[model samples]
Target: MADGLNDQRTVRVADLLSDFRTLQYYIAAAPTEPSHSDDYYCEGWAALRQCSIDGQHILNCAAETRVPRVRGGPDEQAKTELQQVMLDSFSRRHEAQKIYLRQAAAQRWVEWRDSILCGGRPHSGNASQLASCDAQLRIDLAAITDDSIYSDMRSSDYQMGRWTLEDPRLRDVQRWVRARQ
Candidate 1:
């Protein structure tokens, strides 16, 4: 949110920190399963999104109901101290929430690695085809990176005489794929 020394995006530092946690939620969810799902990751995706919504809701509610600012007075002094205590309490809760989300995300990532590396099909379609050369190639290139390229090839567009495998783009991609192997 900060731009050099100013708030470039006009976003508060607290908001930026919260957004970072939301990203963390997504990363953690990957291990839980389905961050690599076909067409859609389903469960992991939904959970991460829900985590983001929940976090945002918490932040927004806190902001919306912020304690009144203290100015000056013996009475105001006591109010200010109370506000400080509440703020500290909220900070602790926020930190706890962040920790929970981070741990959840890390656990999911480890699970995804275990499933993919140890012969479990966590996601269908290409994710399940990780063991085969041809399948992996298609998964990484056409399916994962370029849906149109994969679909066109699957629908016999190459046989239409307009998109030959010998084309430079396809050839280079094929070469790159082979090189990785």
Candidate 2:
């Protein structure tokens, strides 16, 4: 039981890292031209960095908890405490991501609105539509975070850490934005 618990904790920490990597990829691939402001990119970058830092902390916490000296017995309290920490970290990261996403979505909307309102395009997937799409994506992402699927995945047995800026999931988001253009 102890071995299983340790393994689960390790894997959960790894999954958090994976999520962070995906976020990094998404932020890096974000459209700077559409945003038209360094401040926007800076905010996104900061959020990604925060996610990475949180993931590292969660990994360290998992390692510490797995060590015999830190948690010697098969105490449910220890496991529960660790789980709460993981969840709290995830929640904080998700909240930060939400703020970034919202800002990005708003920027995209403004770009589209300007294009349409200025007669640049005749209602052929302009900023308003892009804004709507971004809003929907934010809603979907919020729902997923509320479901806490990532947190549950961490409790599994898979050491899936070391995220990079090339996750397919983030690519899909980029594609969605381009599809509007």
Candidate 3:
């Protein structure tokens, strides 16, 4: 999706950086309300996933040796620019990944809420079937929180440290899920 930033023309680092910043702002401002459409969660999650991919690509580009004659060669200035761009992309990606996790939790909370409202069981109601569904959702959540994204502190390129800060909305959702369980 972001290939255009690198492929459509000369790698315009400024344009790429602008795109990253815009996405970061969009993700940060995304609605966390339950009343918001599923589209918001879907779009945000997709965007974050794409950001992770693009961030990794940028990191890889930064790590590669620059040949002297091809693609304008590598210079000290170019290296520094790449470093800054990669850092910015990764730093934003890390935060966006956490937001995606919160969205997943919120979506699950909504599912649980619906199930409860339907008299402690979903329409499918088969224990084995529900177990399978739960497993799938858990797997999906795990993917978003995977080591490549947010779960591993080592993967955090920016010194954000461990994800220790609490998201109050997430906490409330967790509490509700536990109380119902």
Candidate 4:
């Protein structure tokens, strides 16, 4: 146990490097734009969010290592280099976090869209059921329309597909319901 402190620093530095690389991979793999599929977007976002946590942990580890407990330790120079590398990686990781937030906003949009669109396939296909679905959907939409996130989403860099951005929202589902009636 004489080398325990050195061993702990070694382990922490190794963990920091591993997490740094994982953060880079997540940033590289991140979608250029949000996907239409909720599952796809959610899965990707979850991975990125986890990486964000890892990145933060890396930063914390780097800070701890930089505390200069023993200035002339054998690995001091190596630790200094690692700290610089970690700092550089952190900037890229911050950009990844922005992407993560935009994706979360995009996912919210998808959920709202799905809530309205899923109303079309009731088992009964009866007018009463269709009307009930529409009523609930309208209420749901109304409840969320005033949320400022949608406005931020409008200004965000990602593109919503043509089908989603069309005028008179819920057009497709409304048409289907009218046809059924």
Best by TM-score: 2
lDDT for each candidate structure: 0.40, 0.44, 0.43, 0.41
Write the residue-wise lDDT of candidate 4 on 42-108 in tens digits. Answer: 3334534554564445344323223344465657655554443333333333333443444444345
Residue by residue across 1-181, what tens digits does model 3's lDDT show?
Answer: 1222222122433433554465555544543443434434443334444445543443333322342332433444454445444444444344445554545554564565446445443355455555554565556656664344443533342244322222123333333323332
Candidate 1 lDDT, tens digit per residue, 78-179? 444444333333242333244344445534543554555565443465454333532332233232233344344334533543322222243443333333
Q: Global CA lDDT of candidate 4, please?
A: 0.41
1 against 2, candidate with superior lDDT: 2
Clashes of 1: 4
Error of 1 at 132 (Å): 26
Name the top lDDT candidate. 2
Worst lDDT window (10 residues) for model 2? 162-171
**How do the predictions measure up, each by TM-score?**
0.32, 0.37, 0.34, 0.32
The CA lDDT at 99 in model 4 is 38
Instruction: Give the true-structure RMSD of model 1.
Output: 20.2
Q: Per-residue lDDT for 1-181 in model 2, tens only?
A: 3434644554554565566556555554554442334334333334334444544443333321332334446555565555544443444344335434544554454454454456453355564564564465456435544235434333332344432222223334333323332
